[model samples]
Target: MIRGVRGAITVENNIEAEILSATESLFKEMIKANKIKAVDVASVFLSVTDDINAAFPAKVIRMQEDWTYVPVMCMKEIAVPQALEKCIRIMMHWNTELRQDEIQHTYLEKAIQLRPDLTKQ
Candidate 1:
């Protein structure tokens, strides 16, 4: 069965540089945790917090890596009060035989505190 994995990062600033750095780290950890390869991923959906209107994190992610043809989408995260700031989140649907418990989700930086249990799991 296929599985969906999620990951997130918190940017230090709204600037493109900070966003790129955080996103890069986030993607690395996410792919590592989930044992993902280009062939395993079906699609990735990325969303940035309202404060991060500078650049699309997903585009930066693709540019940083030579992903040639993987499908990635970007959007703005809902602006909820007291929500995480300058955050970039991703949901990747992958074709895998792993069970739900075997799927790994990464939440790094400030996002690490979002779900401590999952981070440890």
Candidate 2:
């Protein structure tokens, strides 16, 4: 079976450092919550709001030696009126037996408001 863990975070600004830091932090937490090793990851898709163009989110993941071989892609999120800004979102596919509802989805910083239902805990 395959499962996916979703995560998103808002960066403090559009600078490369801030984007990389926030994205890396979100990836770490999502990976931890899913209890998945790099080898278990099939692929990762990351997208950021139009407001963010400072860096490639996948580049930050590749910086980790363990993820050197993991397949990753980064793209710009769809621009919608009043859409979340400085938001980086990732959906990681993992080969696991966990059911859909069993997986954990994480939203950090202002992105948390994007999924208020999940933040209840």
Q: Which of the numbered candidates is closest to the native, going by highest TM-score? A: 2
1-121 per-residue lDDT for model 1 (tens digits): 5688989889888888788888888888888877788777788899988788777788765774546577899988888999888789988888898898898899988888777888974
* TM-score to native of every candidate shown: 0.91, 0.94
Q: What C-alpha lDDT values do all the predictions have?
A: 0.83, 0.89
Candidate 1: residue 63 lDDT (0-100): 72
- Where model 2 places Cα greater than 4 Å from the true spot, the runs are none
Residue pairs with backbone overlap in model 2: none
Query: Residue 76 deviation, candidate 1, in Å?
Result: 1.1
lDDT of 1: 0.83
Q: What would the TM-score be for candidate 1 when compared with the true structure?
A: 0.91
